[model samples]
Target: MKNMDVMLLSTSCIQSQLMKELLSESLGPSITLVNQHTFAYHDWNKPALILVDLANLPTSNQPWELYLRGFKDNISTVLLNTQDSISAQKLLQWPNVYGYFSHYEDQETLIRGLTKVLKGEHWIPRSMLIEMLLYLQSIKPITTTSIELTSREIDVLNLLSNGKSNTEIANELFVSEHTIKSHLYKAFKKINVKNRVQAKRWARCHLPLYDG
Candidate 1:
């Protein structure tokens, strides 16, 4: 209620007016709702949350998306009236997008979610959060030398990436399966991987001599 700015980017004048009134009443009169069709003239550095209605935008690269690319720092955004989870997930991948509201969301749910977003908290689903985390983990830079893996661990990972099972790796290394498991566990911990598949993926990216 302390003059928090909320910019509504919508094409329809009637809808924008209605939404502005609703938000003002629900979120308190101190909340400033800057209803506008374009965002080019606004100061990008201001502390404001942008609520973009995706329904009125074209199917291609949106105006907000293009405008967002200009700024070096992240701008907080909440996507409204998203068609489905696929689009929501894709948009949420942008660092600025922290909240989403489907067309089917009730007034109460929308208001509650907006409140959370205003507090600088994420309003995304748990499943989406998990998927984002996994994606970030996969793309995160980890040089092979950074983890300082033991020679046996590196050998095990190289073989693992080449579709070799634990038993096969053990046989190739002339060590027992238990020893191979120990090496894998240590490697996984060092590399922050939870399982063989993740370890293998990491190996493929970091290990230059990986066969697979």
Candidate 2:
């Protein structure tokens, strides 16, 4: 791995020097410090991993997404030196960022993180993953208000939401069990749900205006 370049991106001169010394001393001497101006010039070296010091760099203007896009399947990316781990949890959503370590962590921990990342393993904070899951659940749209469901489907869904079994709903609506199942299947498709529980949640949220 001595031939492989490890790109360290940063805007601060002092930090660039410090991180460079750290990587070179702890990891090895193969580390190359590069900024936006020099990064394009070294594309031929083909850095194996990018350790992004987001605390210094103006991340929005860098087209970092496109830079990652151009790397295809080769380069592994990691983010560091952030103020908030909870808020920074969103970066885990990106496939390229396989590793994330808060800059405040000890050098030993960061070295362990880098070792794991270079071994093709992820290194995110455990709490960040938990926060990410809760955040995803919070943002996940139920689509009850957004979806357009048919009246017959709504009827079946309403009964289903009210805890009526398929046969019970069919009897209450004076429809055949086959007809009720058909309505349920269609409702599930329209609302983008799979099972009776999800269908019930959708119906309860969306059916306030429903009379049928």
Candidate-wise lDDT, in order:
0.68, 0.67
**Top lDDT: which candidate number?**
1
Pairs that collide in candidate 1 are none
Residue-level lDDT of model 1, residues 1-212, one tens digit each, is: 13445777766567766887888788654433443334666765566667777776553333344344324353567888887655333654344777788888999999998888776788988877787677556553435466787555766787788788888776655569999899888899999999988988889888644544
lDDT of 2 by residue, 1-212 (tens): 33456878776498688988888788764677887555654554454677878777775313343244244355667887766533533474343677777758788998987877777688876877677667656553434566766655655676687788988776655569999899888778888899998887766666652223
Candidate 2 regions exceeding 4 Å error are 1-3, 44-47, 64-66, 85-89, 93-95, 131-212
Question: Which one is best on TM-score?
Answer: 1
Give me the displacement of residue 99 in model 2, in angstroms. Answer: 1.4
Pairs of colliding residues, candidate 2? none
Q: What is the alpha-carbon lDDT of model 2 when measured against the actual structure?
A: 0.67
- How well does each candidate superpose onto the true structure, as a TM-score? 0.57, 0.53
Global CA lDDT of candidate 1, please? Answer: 0.68
